[model samples]
Target: MPKTLIVVYADGAAHPGDIAVGLASWARCVFVTEPADHTRAMEPLLSQFGPVITTGSAAEAAARLRPYVPDGLVTYSERALRFAAEVASALELPFHDRPTVGRLTDKWLQRDALRAAGVDTVRCHRIATENDWARAVADTGLPAVLKPAHGGGSRNTFLVTDVGEGLELVRGLLSEERPGLVAGGALVLEEYLPGRDLGPFGDYVSVESIVRQGQVTDIAVTGKFPMVPPFRETGRFWPSPLEYEEEERARELARRSVEALGVRSGLTHTEIKLTPDGPRLIEVNGRLGGGINELSVRALGLNLIELAGRTALGEAVPTPDFYRGRAYFQLFHPAPRRASTLLGIEGVEEVKRNAGVTLYRPYAKAGARLPGGVQTQELDIVMGEAPDVTELATIAKEVEATLRYRFAFADEPGAAVTESSVTGAELGAL
Candidate 1:
């Protein structure tokens, strides 16, 4: 039977058209869906592949995937990654080790595994009750971070500096509804280390290789931009901007963590933080890059999608190099307003006229109330590539300023968008 590539994802604010594009580039057939949007973004791209199947969710699409595709691989999205692993196991197809994937996804379990393997990491503990939380707080101390044991995207993350705050946070956490998590068994509490929040925080390297006869082959690194706290990734920059010495140090530490974790083949998106002391583990996702991988494909000039397909098929792989110069991504963040309608772009002509900006797009439409809180919004994303960060930042600010949305609060007297609290009125998230 011929091989097929399957990618799974949950419907949400934004459709991962980039993931669909990557899968379509390599697989004989591609499938993707966005249940919430009641929309599918891959109808055009999937045409190149043999057959493109669109359904409501990853699980629904999994049923339509042909058994002929003997193997599969998953990229960044947490829901898609786990669903792919489960689907692979059910189909009796070669897939990543379930235990390893579990450890990678759960923060507390990951710390335990690393400690057992003699890998250095921050102190962490798991709790499911008031008694457990108290014990964990005593052991880890005040100024701690609380997170769902198996959560992603920083949905319910809380930072507490004292026991009282911790208690309040715990109460709030217990009260809030979390819909995506399957295992409600545990919550993780860890010592919160205060330092610079690297956007993307660390490099999300997607090492692609084959484990043949117990030998590892093929490895590639995809550098990521520092991310904002609680899993909101601003963007990814390839070939890390670290000095040569720092870069070497980071690579060695990454190698140690990878070997310690026993990752033999496939792609791994590992995050490591450089502290005043040294590098500490920040969890690793056993999959290809999310936005970083896409930047890598363009910057590194590698066919990662195809490479992953070959590896899944048990084929040999080749080493790849980084793109010349630098490639940076500026994630669009809502400037700072609510209930805003995209009034249409104002300075687009001027922005497009500027050099170094390769692409411009607004993922949200007009008349949509911008979702508040530290979450992703379609209006917040404008992807562009440039030779360096300085140029990228300049162009990003210009584009951000140029793109305007009109917002009118229901309680306000008139249809006014300006704010009287601060200097100038704005409608967006920054």
Candidate 2:
């Protein structure tokens, strides 16, 4: 008999469509969602996976799902982890303890935990007022990063070169005139981990691991495209091109990091930066990493969504086949910092026709107003496969060359970047 699992779904790494497809054969998944503006409309589509349980709160959700007696519960969204934990505990199913979930969700607490466990030493302080600047800098030093203590997807994150700029940025973030989507409704100032330049690729890599009953199985080390300014991620690829020793070191640190956070089960995505000294911890994600499932399925022939679901249900699953099957990639086109209205975009047909380009997804239609952040303000994404990273670079370039955007800058009246100029992250700075 198929196990019945309750999935607390929301915005995050896992795409609802892919989860729906993955759950069709493995289990009877009842997707529980809150009554929120962003998710209310997706109920129809979510129901395709199984029954849709709509509740206004986590308590209500657990109450409603009690009669069903689901065998397990899972959540892909960091925002919904706490909710899922609550529901799972109510139903006597497996899930992370509240303190572990707190460390996973809160950046300040995670850093503190890593430091306590001797896995990390980066100093971090939560910022509640301007007075904390001196103390923050005293601990973290110059070139610090200001981000939400409980944020992900690099939302409302900034790098400050001086104290004046840091204060100004924080004021802007909290002010009524320019409040933005900040994770956890607060800020964290911490030391920035600089990386050795590995030209053509970002210095960061993530470890994909599946832990079962205190055993950590390290999978592939995922590579990245050099970020656009202000910490905007451009792209990510599977089968990271890290040197043999470095990859092993990364996997070891990831294992230690998760164990330090008391992660004994489920999937983990640990981000690490390749500094001159060694790989440093960049925050561990409790759920699937963004764009991981897409590239993993295409390149490695793995369906992580189903695998994760089954693992949560205590079903035995296969260890990942990490052979270098192929190189899969997703390069995002982020809107320029000042672009407000998307006037026009050129080369959609050309990009789709580009060599090795398998899919071209354009999110913003012409004339749509853009908020101009790192992740959410993305204009489009181009994905494809190559034999290796070296050859994948050529294919990615061809796809990039075909994309061009014309946008009206709201701050600068009548100013627009046309098809003739540089596109993506090259045209602007954070």
Candidate 3:
């Protein structure tokens, strides 16, 4: 008889597809999901492993799982981390406590904890009203970032270069009837670390690791492509192009950041910025790097989802080993435009013919209306690998030139349709 693993499934949960396959080989996996999520796409994938329990609230979900006596409780949903923590506590399963999860999930709390631990981080202030906004500008100065204290995916985040711009952006953000993901509609205004000198690789990289019994192991460093203005992530490449010294420095910062947040057992993703002086903390996540898990598994030859589950079960896990190669993941978005309809994509077949191309998923369908932000409007992603960086660059260029996205806007006088060719430089920032 195998041990049972309980998973909390929701919109932001670890990629359900990957988790389902990964856990099936290790344990009797049970999924606790909302009634809305137990639909056609998820139900069939999850049902293959074990029972799929549907409940409306966290309490109900926990009650349903109590009988299973799960050996581990896990979730990758940012919104469900606290709920999962509570359920794990009730089940006597391994997980971070609510307070620790709070520190990891909330940007303001995360910065406070890191700073108190003597880890380098930027000065930040909480803003909930007009008065709070004024104080933040006065305190943090111009060229700062204002974002939801509890947000993810760069949604509703703004970079204000002056007081007037900050005020205007905050006013608009506050006026929204429903600001999604901004807890209590509060904002965190923090000093901006100018990343101009980091060169084409950008000024930031994310450290991916797994923690067990308060011990952290550095797995890999992922290099980021330049973000669209105001901090929207466009793409990422791994293993980081940074030299050995810089990689070690960022890894150390990540370890300190995770330890300060009191993460005991699970996967951790820490984002750090390399300023002229040294590495500084940007944010820390209490879950696996979203969407990067697939790339990591292919490049590093490690099953992170399995590692996360095994760690929660108190099993001793081995340090990860990597194979030689370079891989990149880039998300395509319709930028500098609003409310456009996706018409079609071209050369997808040609891009797929390349041996180096591993995954090319297009989410935007013909007649689909795209929203305004990077979080909502990303239309597709291209992932691939090659023997080395030079070969990888060539592969990326071929894919970028081969695929074309077509769009149209109804508001235009003639409903003009447009075709944009994606370039490797734009996709990988090479």
Candidate 4:
């Protein structure tokens, strides 16, 4: 029998269809989810690959997964990272090591670790309670970012332009209304890293890495389009548009940051911003960057998901040396902040008609409630391959322009009955 790998699965994560496809290239794969969220619908996608183990407690889950003799344990969700670490520990499997899990999951702790290791010296303060808001503001000051210390995918993340706005935002976070903010997770205020004017591209790029026994293998540098607002990313392209020197700086910083965080073995996504002063460290993610697998496979003939899974299985994966086939990219038009429910999406066929387009996956359909103001809450994803960055940009813009969205506004009195159609609205502003 081949080796088995236990994947800690959850909703708002790398899709099972994608995971199944990758794991099929290696050892048998089993998915384990907590009692809560959504494995039944995903089972059809994974049925051919392996079973999904859902249990009420960690101990029970460990017991269930133990019989598979899983050689590697992994999770791709920030919310599930710690839980996966615990289960990995229980199984005595190869993972990020139990002691260092906090630095991977908690934004504040992660920053502290980075700062301590001299990888990044970005100043930050933890807001433990509503009362701590002023002190946090004093520490990090205005014109900073305030976000849930344990959050990812931009949930409850905001820019604090003033002290009053900061206090009100903190209150909203500590209130019952923001359930997705991670229960009992303290907020962190950090100095905002201003970005340079990159013209057509976003100011930041991401470095995707696969690690084994603390050795880092950088696969690609992923570039971004300008964020919609506050900080909702719109899309990503492979073979970053950054200058060679800038790209090297990002990869080096990512290497240093990963080592600083004590990531023993796993896939890591380190986001770095190109600021006026120089390249600055953005947050580092312990899982595969969304869209990285697609970009890598299409543009470089690299199966990142497969490689990461193999790394988990104790395989000594090597650094990739590949010539690019083309520029591959993925884009999303996020739901506007005012959107409460999606009434319709139009022109998808037209978007498909665009040259170089490959896939159009809608995240929301008619009559579905819009997931509140987060970058992760996208209306749809448009994927394609272009001859170069210039061509990719043209296709991406055309695809985004061709589609239309009809939404019911959350704050409008008669939004329940009234549906409004618009190309899109800027996020982070209602």
lDDT of 3 by residue, 114-135 (tens): 8899986588998888779888
Candidate 1 lDDT over residue span 1-430, tens digit each: 4456655445321234555455554455445444433334445543545455555444555566654454654434565555666666666656666776677666777788788878766789887665677888888887887877876555666666778777766666655565225544467888766544344234333333334323444343444444444444545555554555655555566555656666656666666665655555666665554555556566666655556556665767665643436755645444232444444445545656667666566665545654444443435455567776566656655665665555434434475455222111133223
Task: Report RMSD for candidate 4.
Answer: 2.4
What's model 4's lDDT at 176? 48
- Alpha-carbon error at 158 in model 1, in Å? 3.0
Instruction: Rank by lDDT, highest first.
Output: 2, 4, 3, 1
Q: Each model's RMSD to truth, in Å?
A: 5.1, 2.4, 3.1, 2.4
lDDT of 4 at 272: 95
What is the Cα-based lDDT of residue 55 in candidate 2? Answer: 76
The lDDT of each candidate is 0.55, 0.80, 0.75, 0.79
The alpha-carbon lDDT assigned to residue 133 of candidate 1 equals 73
User: What is the lDDT for 168 in model 2?
Assistant: 85
Error of 4 at 365 (Å): 2.9
Better of 1 and 4 by lDDT: 4
Give the C-alpha lDDT of model 1. 0.55
Cα lDDT of model 2 by residue, 77-97, tens digit? 887887788778777889888
What pairs collide in candidate 2?
A: none
Per-prediction tally of clashes: 18, 0, 0, 0
Candidate 2 residue 194 C-alpha distance from true site, Å? 1.2
